[model samples]
Each structure stands twice: as structure tokens, then as C-alpha cells.
Target: MVQCLSHRVELAFKDAMKKAPLYSKVYSLMDELFKFYHKSAKQSAGLKSSFEALNITPCTPTRVGGTRWLGHTLTALNNIWKGYTAIVKHLSQVSVTTGQSATQPKALYLLKLLRSNDVITFAHFLTDVVAVLAQLSKALQKRETCLYEVHQQLLATISNIKKFQTRPGPELRKVQRPDGSFAGESLTGDTTQHSAQMPKLLTALVETLDRRFSDIDEGVLCATKLADMNAWPASLEDSTNG
Candidate 1:
């Protein structure tokens, strides 16, 4: 039952993100990019070569699919973020490869989409958000986790995600200046509009979490904490009076 609830929350998160245009586009592009290399031996080899050239460890792109759990989604996002430079280089080289003219335009388009400031920002932001969700999901699946523990962890995860409204995650902070300006080589244009969308995205996520978990009996869950011996009153008289 706990594992099921966790999956429901993750699905709610995906639904909420799909409602946002920026996130929708970013995730779609991630899936497309993964498929672009995944379908071809030549492209995959070129990507590995690019990784080697840049001194990045060779790793395959993981697909972001609807059927995947949040942990898999997080892995896919992290893979993309880590291979950002190598992916760009590989795509650039592939776009000019001879005899692969048909793949050239597609590769170039994916490259252009991946390099957009909005895409870069939200991609990193998602990695951070999903990381939190993934951890919660992993915890809830543990055999030792009880109802009260699940409730506590769920609330804690929500609180941590809400903090993103004011303070962006480490991955996001790396590409953003203290003054709220874009600070990376991948970003060149004014991203004020895109940056403004982050809070709204986080709002959607928090609201979804609250709504999805509403069915869980919080009062009952809280009451379960009393079962813990550590939560008992120190004196027998105090316990009797209570």
C-alpha cells in the first residue's frame, strides 16, 4: 500500500509537469534525444567518442518514459545533465556527417532545443526536484518503513520541495547568477520570462502533493507515533494522568 501511494504521487507529479508548457517541452526533448542516439549504432558510437574527447565517462542516455518510476526518471535526467557537453559536441558532429544527411537535420534540431536557456534551466531544476522525490520513493519502499514513518517522510519531502520557490537547487544555481541572471555559456539571451516560471512550477508540484496525499489519514498516522516506546511519558503517574 505504501509503495502504491508513492507511485501515485510520482504520477501526480508527472501530470502536473505536463500541464506546464516549458516542462512538457523539456521532458519531451529529453526523450527524443535519448531515442535519437538509442536507435542508431553510428550515433551512439559518435556520442561515446565525444565523451572520450571531453574526458567524460562514457554512458548511454537513459530514456524518460511514462511507465518509468521516479528513480528511473531521475537517472535519465542526471545522465543528460552530466553528458550535456558531450551530447552537444556529438550532435554538432553528427549534423555534418556525410552520408547521414537524413539524420543531420534531426540531430541539429535536437541540439538547438537542448541548448535553449529555458530547457537548460528547467532540466537542471527537474533533476533536483526528482532527486528529492526519488529518495522519498526509495524510503517508502523499504520493508521497515511504517505508516507513521511514511507520513513523516512525505511531509518532509514536500517541505524540502517548497523551499525551491525561494532557493533553487545546486544544479540550477550553477547556471544562474546571484543577481538572477543567466551565468553559463549555454545561455545567451534574456531568460527573465523562463526564470519566472520556476515558482509557478514548484507551486504546481506542492499543490499536487497535497492533493494526492489527502486520502491518507494524517490523524491516524500521527496517532501511530504514540506506539513508539520513545514517545511514552517518563513516569507511570504521568502516563496514567495522560
Candidate 2:
């Protein structure tokens, strides 16, 4: 009998930025924005208080660690997303008022970058995509998790992805324009192409997940069948001795 110990099904959606420069740019911009916000949140009492008053949670960006779990990236993206408006407002204020500061130019650059329609779309798309990976990572981290449960989680994630493909969910609307408008339909060129390819990416993810886990899936099914008491005799008859 063979029992598969551990397997990692690489999620295709996680690599959406590999061949696409726009996705990479969006990812980098989000991280850079988070670094600025995190620094401000830590150094400025007034900003922290503002966040609290505005009901925004203060958080920092987390990069992908050396471990198999890549949820930290998702978390970082989420934190930036949760504070998108606050970051924009804060950066704008700083860029306008803090002219003598050495970081003023960078702040102004980031402020303009954040206001772009493509950046907004890509950020929303990334947050949504990473969320799926985060759920799977959390499930796989459980101490008592089994292959059966893992399979179930994989299937659930795939279903969710399909749902998103058919009718892209609420994440797309999460990043509102700095002017308080939606950035849904105005995407153009590369960003539009990337966004339109999401369904294909998700479909590939589902296929890859199923292919990678096929062996473990078989093992899970076999184990489940063997564990079913009603499917087997309670006692085996002795052939030679009895």
C-alpha cells in the first residue's frame, strides 16, 4: 500500500504576474504603498488616530516567506486594500505639505500611481485571486487535516473560482477611486487584457489542482472505503489454523 505524505498543488492564479508586466507592476506598487502606510502608521500618532477614527485598521505588508504557505502575501495585499483610501488621502496630504522631506518626491509618485485606473483594477483582481490561495493555505496548515478534508477544500476553492470567473465578485469593487467612484469599466490595454484572462487563469488553476492531487485523491478514496465498517466483514475466517 502506498500513502502519499505531502503534496503541493501549485495554484495557477498565484502566478498571474509571471508573464504579465502589468500584474507585476500592480503587485510591486501595492507592496510599496503598504511600506509607506506601515511606516506612517508606526511613526505618526496623528495618522494612527485618524485611522482609528475612520474605522480603518492599521496594518503592514507581509512578503512571501520561505515556508510553503504563501498567505502572508495575501495578508499584505489585503491590508493595503483595506486602507487604500486612507493611504491615498494620507499620501496626498504629505506630498502637499511636506515639501522639505526627502521622501516627498517618492510620495508624490506613489500618489499618482495609486490614482491610475489600471493600478486600481489590478489591485482588486490580485486581492481576489490571492484570497483563494489564502483559504487553501489555512486549511492545509491544520494539524489534524487529512487528505479527504484537503480534497474537499480544493474542490470548494475551485467552485468559488468558477463563480468568480462567471461573475467576478465583490473584490473588484473594493478599491474605489480616490474621488469615490468605481474603477470597473474604464480599464484599457494591458490591464484590460489581464483582467479578461482571469477566467482562463482560474480554469487552469482548477485543472492543475486536480492533476496534482490525483494520486492523493485515490489514496483518500481507498482509505475511506477501507474505513467503512459496513463495507467489510467484521471478522475474517481462519483458513490454515482454524
Report the number of clashing residue pairs per model: 0, 0
lDDT, residue 167, candidate 2:
74
Off by over 4 Å in 2: 1-13, 16-20, 37-46, 49-69, 98-101, 175-191, 217-242
Error of 1 at 76 (Å): 1.0
User: Residue 229 of candidate 2: its Cα lDDT?
Assistant: 45
Error of 2 at 34 (Å): 3.4
lDDT of 1 by residue, 1-242 (tens): 87777687787787668546777767777788888889998889989999899898987788876553787788887787778788888888888879888899998888777767777777778888888888888887777888767667778898999988888888887766644333234454556646777777788888888787776656765587666566689999989999
In Å, residue 156's CA in model 1 sits off its true spot by 0.6
Q: Write the per-residue lDDT of candidate 2 for residues 137-174, one digit (tens) a residue.
A: 66676777755565567777778877877675578765
Q: What is the lDDT of residue 204 in candidate 1?
A: 85
